[model samples]
Target: MTDPANPLVSTEWLEKNLATPDVRVVDATYYLPVEDGDARAEYEQEHIPEAVFFDIDAIKDDSNSLPHMLPSPEVFSSKVRKLGLGDGTRIVVYDRKGLMSAPRVWWMFRVFGHRDVYVLDGGLPKWKAEQRPLDDHPVLPEERHFTARFDTTRVRDLNKILGNIESKAEQLVDARSAGRFEGRDQEPWPGRQSGRIPGSYNVPYTNLIDSQSGCLKAPDALRRQFEDAGVDLQAPIVTSCGSGITAAALAMALDILGHRDVALYDGSWAEWGLSDKLPIEKGPEASASVSTER
Candidate 1:
């Protein structure tokens, strides 16, 4: 169980308190193209009783070429309102694969000025394995008013990130695998150049998760992981992943570790990798043995 003061909540805690009027459970499941799975279809088949499926891909900056970019405040407000989210609601988001998609949704809510949100530790698999509860029927929710206030400061654009790369004003943390970071592996998206941004540290998102349990490791474990990876948690970090999804998991862990100034690169490698002009580096920096490319 999570401390009442913290943002995270366990499946057991959610099961016991889901009936609270102020609480809302959301299934924020999204699969990578490589997974060959349908998140929506799986949600429709079964989910936590009243949980609504929050489609991360469908709601985004439609005008942008980037995949699943953050949507405008008005757009987000209208969409989530239709999904029954309200200003006073305390949201608990979960994904089929634990720490994958849920933290992205949690960060989305936070960027929209909604702080009373959290990700479910261990997600649906853990809940099901424990024989807690499940429902296949569609959920019907009462309509509620949702107001969105986009906090631009919380998000960093491509130009801003590029400037940071040269200035070293903030730490760049890439969540992609070491192979992807070092330009040795091709990205899932074709035509994108392999390599990480110059000066960015390589800390694969998988390192932050417990492989067996599909949950975030404890804070001490997370600290050690970052430290061993040559990351300075005391410095401001801007996290990036294949797109912008898994980076949120890194951001969440940083938040849990009490690092306040963490931010996410909304375009991430999806944009950087596609461009030929962006600087790329291969091999690790002196600070860390992991290879990195830009």
Candidate 2:
């Protein structure tokens, strides 16, 4: 049986419960522009049985110019309802590239107040490696009533991020690679500058996953990874990434470590770097202090 208390589930558990009436599987595969891949096209080729596709790009705040910002509660409810997700449904989200984008969808469900959602640890890669059953047929689930109660505490906006810079009330953590965070590499999005928020610390989301199994590390290891990256466990934290995708991974990791006061910057670097108006830092992390004045 899948542990509802845990944020993740093993492929073995999913394989056994693939046919559970109350369980719903979602393939939340997302690819960066740099990867030159299509997620839906992949789902058409092969995916977990009864797994519906959740397109982050399509189910977003269309009013915003930024990519994949959270949609309104009504919009989110409407979309997910059509996907057969609703009250009492045990949502199991997974992505093609292991833990990359699955956690983002998991976080989205939480933001909408769905407490029974979980990510499939190791994702499709690990499932394929083990030669598990797969299907190419599309699933059309009967529409269900998905109630969305917006939880503001789980999400942060550009204004909140800017305000925190001065107030230093919450620690900012960046999940982008060290190169991108340091401004040494080109950003995935065009016309955006490379760098990080002024005081955010780097804890590249990849560090939280196991290389061989493509699974998230144990709770103790995750704690050490964050501490080694200079994160203070007791403080409130806001996680950001290239476009708020992988940032959710950090938020999930923190949740796994039992940190309760974590929020995700929905705009993340995609919004912050688009304009030069925001202050940014271009090298290694400045210090352990929450405020790093530029």
Model number with the top TM-score: 2
Q: By TM-score, how accurate is candidate 1?
A: 0.93
Model 2, range 86-180, lDDT digits (tens) per residue?
Answer: 99899999999999999999999999999999999999999999999999997999999998989999999998998998899999999999999
Evaluated at residue 28, the lDDT of candidate 1 is 98
Q: What's the TM-score of every candidate structure? A: 0.93, 0.96
Candidate 1 regions off by >4 Å? 1-5, 284-294
The residue ranges of model 2 lying beyond 4 angstroms of the native Cα positions read 284-294
Per-residue alpha-carbon lDDT of model 1 for 1-294, expressed as tens digits? Answer: 335346589888999988888889999999876679999999999999899999998889889988899999989988888788888888999999888889999999989988889999999989999999998999888878888888877789889997897789998898899988877787887677777888888888889888898778999998997888889988889999999999998889888999889899999988987887777776644235333333
Superposed Cα deviation of residue 244, candidate 1 (Å): 0.3
Q: What is the lDDT of candidate 2?
A: 0.92
Which residue pairs in candidate 2 collide? none
**lDDT (CA) for every model shown?**
0.86, 0.92
Cα misplacement distance, residue 80 of candidate 2 (Å): 0.7
Which candidate wins on lDDT?
2
